[model samples]
Target: MTYHHLTIDELTMIANFRDQGVKAYRATKLLHRSLETVYRVYRFLAAGHTLQEYYQHYRENKAHCGRKAIQLPTDEVTYTKAKVAQGWTPDTIMGGHSAVVCGRFTAFSSGAILICGPCR
Candidate 1:
């Protein structure tokens, strides 16, 4: 399974379980997590930290305001547009990747060859 960030509630639960004298194996069963996860939680608590502290640290480490816009490269755009005007479809412009061809065509329409690579 793909790893997901541990939730604030899960962290709280882990810390609370450890404080209640629950062993890591039993804690794992309760939390539906692996023993390693329980071990990490116990270690964190034993280090004199609280669940809130861990969650806050985690949030600060990964917090971002927003995603930056994706800009097409200038020369890539020019070349793609030129190729399109010369009767090349997005498929040909992309050199035959059907998935990429469809996405670019849908986004930019047929007239503009959307450059799919480095500006050259």
Candidate 2:
């Protein structure tokens, strides 16, 4: 199954379960989530921290999640776009391996090239 972040309600429920002196394992069984997943949120905040504080922290942390945006130099970006306009696929341009520039290689996915190292 695809991964998904926890919702606010789920976070609240986890906090509630923690408040009731219930173990994280019990919340995991009820929430159909892994123990670590439930426990992480349960421990996201300590006593005396308000729910809003939890939410604020959640939002801030969420901003750093998700796929990192593709970051290539302007020249590379232009070259890739030009190659793409000519009917070449990204994987093909990436050579199904690494884009070696000046004898250096940047790690990229086999299926997609998100970023390339400085080849200039």
Candidate 3:
């Protein structure tokens, strides 16, 4: 979706609702805007300063949704054996072993190691 900049009027409305104790999600619905947009503008207007600070914080937080991608681990002997039996290439085996590892471990906790291996 295309993201338009929050106008001064929209920011004012968000701040008014927040000051009146309206929740962020509900306020977003009331404004007919995305949840993130409402949240960023609420924080921006409430900070009692320039909107740029709020935009910056929103961008930073939005980018902080964890690491981009993870690699598999080489120490997983079971995965290695399975790959060998399947006659898969090293790169293919490494990238495709995530589902098997996730079955044995939490997807995020073991994700990096399972995708790239311990070497990475």
CA lDDT of every candidate: 0.67, 0.68, 0.63
Kindly list the per-residue Cα lDDT of model 3 for residues 18-83, writing each as its tens digit.
889999999988889899878766766676866566656656766765445444345575666676
In model 2, where do residues sit more than 4 Å from their true spots?
Answer: 71-120
- Candidate 3: C-alpha RMSD to true structure equals 9.6
The most accurate candidate by TM-score is: 1
Clashing pairs in 1: 80-113
Superposition-based RMSD of candidate 2 using all C-alpha atoms, in angstroms: 7.2
TM-score per model over all chains: 0.54, 0.52, 0.37
Residue 19 lDDT (model 2): 89
Measured by lDDT, the strongest candidate is: 2
Model with the higher TM-score, candidate 2 or 3:
2
Reference-based lDDT, residue 68, model 3: 57
Off by over 4 Å in 3: 45-120
Clashes of each: 1, 0, 10
Task: Kindly list the per-residue Cα lDDT of model 2 for residues 5-76, writing each as its tens digit.
Answer: 778898888889888988999999998888988866766656567777878887898898655544655666
The lDDT, on a scale of 0 to 1, for candidate 3 is: 0.63
- Candidate 2 pairs with clashing backbones: none
Q: Candidate 1: where is the Cα deviation over 4 Å?
A: 60-71, 77-120
Task: For candidate 2, give the lDDT of residue 110.
Answer: 34
